[model samples]
Target: MSDYKAFRVELKDKIAHVAINRPDKFNAMNADFWTEIVDIFRWVDETDEVRVVVLSGVGKHFSAGIDLGMLAAGTHKYGKDVGRNAELQRRVILKLQGSINAVDNCRKPVLAAIQGYCLGGGIDLITACDMRYATVDAQLSIREVDMGLAADIGTLQRLPRIIGDGLARELAYTARTINGEEARSIGLVNRTYADHDALQAGVLEIAQEIAGKSPIAVRGTKRMLDYMRDHSIDDGLEYIATWNAAMLQSEDLRIAMTAFMNKQKPEFAD
Candidate 1:
């Protein structure tokens, strides 16, 4: 596995765990974080030994949003001239978007395990994942508005599709914090465990289960599902037909069939 300054990555039993490791800063996103996250997800896509990824934070909170210190230092797109500065900021926004898109476009599934705070950019991070689980006491917010900014990352785009447009708009406009139970009730998270330990255990169990599946099938399923989110029903069906035409020819299918017939487990190759 690649060494990451902002994240702790561990691969075991075909499941990769990626935890935000900046507890001293409440895991806030900084320059190193933006750079490293893209690298981490790209590595996940390239590595055949990994099947699923569980994303979490190291301390009591998931993330407190982008580091204000970075902004004060003018680390992001900033220029002295207005015209050039606007262009520079636009470029920076696209770069940040691409960084989060790496997680969304990853071939394998990503499951987010949230504990305390998941605000602003943290929401962007989790909304990009395939699924999200949280501790009951966790707090979440779409907090960019409070900072006089629209969330340019994945949250505004992906969250509306996950929850509904009305609720998404309400959260974006009001910048209100919601507890984990409300997050789950509104379909932001799949489930809310009693505490952080339970959240980690639950998400890890699910990740392990996903890893146990044929990697080809698991990856194809994620691809098709992501496709269906934007395409029409007819378009999705046609696409899946084309997809399975190639995918069905895999040896994993034969192994799966034989395993079912023999009532035994099947070992699939990468």
Candidate 2:
């Protein structure tokens, strides 16, 4: 894998740990962040060795969101023509959305380990993950309204589904910050730890547990859950029926069954 300017990626055992590396800048998302994340997640998607991903940040905060300097510089390039400027801006927003979608659409499940500040674009990033765990003191916010724009990335779309529309709307409109305890109460995060160390340990334990499962089964479960979001219950049932008809034939199933009968741990092939 290539060196990443915005992230530090390490694969150990079957888990891929992707950490935002810009601690000095509060792990702010710059131009490199937008492009490099897509590259990283793409690698994760294609690599059979990688069974799951744990996304976090180096240093005290998860991320303070997009770099203000980069945001301002992007706007400075707009031309005098109103129509052209709007079109250019629209493309930029779409590209940003695609970056977040990389995490959302990755075949393997992603678990976010959040601490400190998770605001603005950070909110977008974590919302895209399959599960989230945070430090009890982690400060999270839907901060786009304060910046004079709607969150154009995944937060506005995904947050509502995770936390429910009423609370999501309140957060977006108020641009208020909530601690991890409140986040857990509202189902924004699955669990909360007392500190960052405990948070990392807890999330890693979960990731390792998931990595021990059959990769094919885990991927298929994620696929089904994502499909269920935009589909009817009947559609989900039919889709999974069609899906398992083929997947049920994998050797992993036989191995799992045999292991169960013998009271042994099943080790699945990648």
Candidate 3:
């Protein structure tokens, strides 16, 4: 695993656990922090050994939004270095988007385990995951309104589809904090745990369950589902067929078929 100053990457049993390590700062993303995040995600995606990735924070809160100290001091400012400002601005936005997009776009499935305060950018990260679990103490908000900006990362886009558009809008506009129980009721979180330890354990267990499946089939399923949600039935069918055409030739197909025939477990070689 690549080293990170603001995070730790632990890989075991084909699962990657990435923990935000800025507990003293509430896990806020600083320039160096997000740089580490981007690199680690790219590293994780490049490996076949990693089948599932889980994101969590190590602190009393997931994050207290972007660092206000940094914001007030304009640490987010960008300059194009003598005529690159415009492109730099776009690149900056893309890079920030990438903090979560890297997680979303990883080949393997990702699960976010949230605890304590999940605000602003934290919402962006969790929303991009394939699934989310939160602790009872979790407090979440689409906090961009208070920060004088829009939720530019992924939350504004993906959250509307997960929770209703109305709920997403209300949260964005009001910037109200909602606890984990309400988050579960509104479909923002797939499950809830009584505390941080349970939250992490639950997500890890779920990740292992997914890891036990056929990697090719599992990854393809995630990709096809994403396509189906965005495309018409006809388009989706053509895409899925195209995807399975090559995947069906793999040894995994033979293993699964033989396992069924023999009434035994399939041991897929990833």
Query: TM-score for every candidate vs. truth?
Result: 0.97, 0.99, 0.92
Query: What would the per-residue lDDT of candidate 1 be over residues 1-270, giving only the tens digit for each residue?
Result: 777788999999998899999999999999899999999998899999999999999999999988888777764556578998888777878898998999999999999999999999999999999999999889999999999988899888999999999999999999999999999999999999998889999999999888888999998999999998889999999998999999999999999999999999889987
lDDT of 2 by residue, 5-103 (tens): 999999998999999999999999999999999999999989999999999999999999999999899988988999999999999999999999999
| lDDT tens per residue, model 3, 16-43 | 9988888999998777766787788888
TM-score of 1: 0.97
lDDT of each: 0.92, 0.96, 0.86
What 10-residue stretch in candidate 2 is worst by lDDT? 149-158
Best to worst by lDDT, what's the order?
A: 2, 1, 3
Regions of candidate 1 where Cα sits further than 4 Å from its true position: 75-80
- Our tally of clashes for model 3 stands at 2
lDDT of 1 at 91: 87
Deviation of model 2 at 240, angstroms: 0.4
Candidate 1: worst-modelled 10 consecutive residues by lDDT? 71-80
**Residue pairs in steric clash, candidate 1?**
none
